[model samples]
Target: MARIPTAELSRYLLSGQINRQGCLRLRRTPFLPRRPPCHNIRPLSTTTPPTSPAVVVVPLRKQLKDQAKALKSSGSSPRKKKKNSDNQTVPGWELTVGIEIHAQLNTSRKLFSPALVPESSLEEKPNTHVSPFDLAIPGSQPLFQPDTLIPAVRAALALNCEIEPVSYFDRKHYFHWDQPAGYQITQFYHPFARHGKIVLYSRDGIAAEDGDRIEVGIQQVQMEQDTAKTLAQPGGVNWLDFNRVGVPLIEIITRPEIHHPATAAALVRKVQMLLGAVDACTSGLEAGGLRADVNVSVRRPGEDKKLGQRTEIKNLSSFKAVEDAIIAERDRQIAVLEAGGTVAGETRGWSLGGTETRRLRGKEGEVDYRYMPDPDLGAVVIGKDLVEFLGRSMGVLPDEEVEGLMGRYGLTAKDAMALMLLDEGGRVEYFYEVLGELEGRLGGEGKGEGSYALLAANWCLHELGKLTEGEDAEPRTGLVTEFVAAGDLAAILYHLHRRKITAKTAKALLWGVFNCEVAPGGVTDAIERGGLWFQELSEEEYAMLADKVVEGEEGVLAEFLRFKQGKSKGYPQGKLMFLVGKMMKMGPEQNLDPASVKRVLGERIEGVYLPQLEGEEK
Candidate 1:
């Protein structure tokens, strides 16, 4: 349970204070109790909380024991697993994975070239957005886009990366049709930021060491230019679309900290969410705005000292694909090793259906890139003022937004996370707007018995989730034409909450509005136009319907008589309900209250039907 001090350690790492042996000298902090100086801290950052006092030196033994006890009491510590009845240990394989995410920066032009990288929806023809510089024509010079730093620095800060004061570009040379320049201008030697970490949790926000959480280390965040798309045409022709050429991108590289494929997938999703939260990238997987290159390796337990040869699965499109590709590659590697075969280092592409990966090419060494300084661009300096300005522009991220939603609207953590994750573009904003309107109508400030935040959240996530079933992680543009407005949704909830209509009626109204079967209108007006208002039968009407149901079902009546005489074996209540439902369905215009129906069915069955059955039995 020994924990490394991540905050202080990262500060040292960024400040170049760590020794050659990777040891940190802790400086004592004032106003905190002093502890004995100690060693034996691993590089892992999971053992200690980031909010721990900023004091440096502490005894490793005491810290470990204390943290262990704390974690044990909280049920968040690693525990020994008992063997199953088969007398075998849990399936164990030390799976190591690192992921590199390429996010397309939201900018008007390319990173180093002024050429436009057209948006995905633009109608521009192929190669229209390219400039001579992007085409690498002779005498064309490169210039850096200063606007790219806003998103890059924002992403760095959001990911807990330390922004470097000075960063420069280098040429990474490789031969490919997509890169007309024969080299990509990238931050190979000194990236914009380094030494960042992202703590990922389970779908429900579980902590690390709980087996469902992970702490992934970010190696660096670098700015680079993207290549154009190469397409294959019929008859052995090749086509290049330069619309995407020289587009700005940020490559986020992580250390090999992932231990499972699912965890890796979750880490990728968490990164995507963070990027989208900061407006650093659109992260549209289907639109090709973001992608992950997962590096996977495996070794047996207790062989931590030996690093296995790894394979890089390049450009898995979606989060699910990331998971599947890693798992497939890991299994493939483990199989090869178990069969007394050597795993080769190579680059592979995800298969057509994402079931497996195909070999792309042998992995190249660093020398192959032929790295050199880019003479066209000078050192990019990020001053303190620029850093502060970019930092302020980073709005609330998912973590903070989750807490804020929970605290403000009295929602559970799961509920909050659901809302944030399924936000489908502006759907989250629409949800909050509806919640506000509902609060106003309820005559409460989200307090007391009338607070409908929970109800609203359930309706939105469940009902709206069904509507936008397969929306990508990125927000979708524009509202679906059939969907109801926030004000209308609020009105629907108000009537349902106030007992003005049954839950069934409210659902019907919502479905109608959502499908455009009923035009947009006030909740009451829509209800009336659709004839969906809850209907309460009069005493006489209820009696008549109950009598008619019994009279119409002669076979069911006989069964009821036998059951009353203790001759038949089934419950009469179910039979009565079936009859009632049949009658209710006969009139679609009438929105009957189910509770009232149940009441009438029970009364008729007990008072009128029971006596008649007893008389018949006699």
Candidate 2:
């Protein structure tokens, strides 16, 4: 038997432990072949991030069966599962959870405050956008945000939420190191809307899960002003970013009824989609924008509907992160229960490397929040008339707008949706308006009049979508001003619709203008210049070609006679198209449709490639 290689065999033997990333790495044997080095063993880098304290689960497939056998045979110390006097699991695994999502309201001004100078005008620095009310200096007063509230009210009503007649703004008092004002302006007693549910969908556009069909219950939705962010440091110091200090935000507080992590994730996704569905929201979880604070807890396996001590995971930016944090906390609590230990209630931070939850701090209840009414801004009067006006006048829901566009303009499904998605981006409606005028022009000009909606949709989705998609910046809808005259696009499309020019010709012409290959109108004029026939075959040229063919060979006359008698055989028609192409090659390069060439050639080729060839004996 050959001796084991010392360096290679070192890994399998008991050896000294070397530290790497806080995990133990075994030392390799000093002896080894110098040329062919041991490449298999990699040095563990000490760059792993710190993780949460939790029992690690080793993955072993048959370990559980082995455990059961040992459990059955061994004598062990008693480990008692916690139970109440009546024999119920104390702080039973049953726990309730709810999500409070705070979405920034898109408006020109801040709520209960005047909008600041535009960020573009200010020098590059923080806290520059701060108005008097934002700084919360003595005697600083907040003004009402009417325009901001309109969209907010519209959004809540669209969610099928119940709005209060007399909603009030309140002060959520707290003294965090970041709180310059000593409290945040918020709502508590009565919020703007309540009992709304958002259907959740994932990034892949699939609903994750459902607890209750139709609507998940929302507890309340409040319109409030946001606090400034505290940029904290590791040592002790933290700076303040007041750019977002007084921005208007709407918080939708949910009920503690979501049954699973998947259902919860799905709910958040649907809310995002619905917001998009109405053009009331940008995509969710934008940079330093919309966020959710999740309350997580699990119930016992046998418990019907009981809740356990819930923990809060605050201000997760994305839905997937929320899903992960919830599952981690739930599993951690389950592990504690199974180990004959009790789980404590605390705010948790999620460690991404290993799916586990860490205790960030103790959880806070309503008492800890210490909510009180704001002194400056009084109760908002949400009267019956105001509610009716706001609800009815909020603007059409996105799905409804899409349907209306489709119905009014006869747009295809893809085109209609694209228009609604454009929001403030495109001149979508203006395109349809021009289509109406084109029909009149076509009738007078004796051109084919295809349906304008289909044509417009084709132009917008297929042509324009491709034309502008990779632009360095967002395409300007205002660029429609250049196209408003109906000279460029209208002329090209009209020519095609009239069948005066083929689609290939129209497309080529449009591309030429767009690419500056030709002046915008240069392509349209070239059609007339090319002389509709491939060439202006003069009478002399035409007669000479026909005479040449007739005199070239007696075999040609025999072939013509065979074709006439329906007995010609062994011929290829594709070659005839090539001949026609050659015949026109020296002619003007008009935008010729290959189909027209095929059509003309079929008549001349006779039964060459057809079932009955020109020389066939049939």
Instruction: Give the whole-model CA lDDT for all candidates, comma-separated.
Output: 0.73, 0.59
**Whole-model alpha-carbon lDDT for candidate 1:** 0.73
Residue pairs in steric clash, candidate 1? 425-475
Give one digit per residue, the lDDT tens place, for model 1 in 1-618.
335455444434222245433344455579766665323221212223365432243333455467667778889765553222121112556777889999999888788778776876234556667676886765678989898888888888999999999999999999886787899999989999999999876653322333555577899999999987755534444445667778999999999877766677777777877887888886455447788899988887776577689999998877657766776787788788889999999999885333457899999878999999999899999999988887887778888888787787777877777677654235566678888888788884444532687778878777666554545322334444226788778888888776678787777777667767666666787777666666567767766766766676767766677787689777677777787786576433354566666687677877887787677767
How do all models score by TM-score? 0.72, 0.56
**C-alpha RMSD (angstroms) for model 1:** 19.8
Clashes of 1: 1
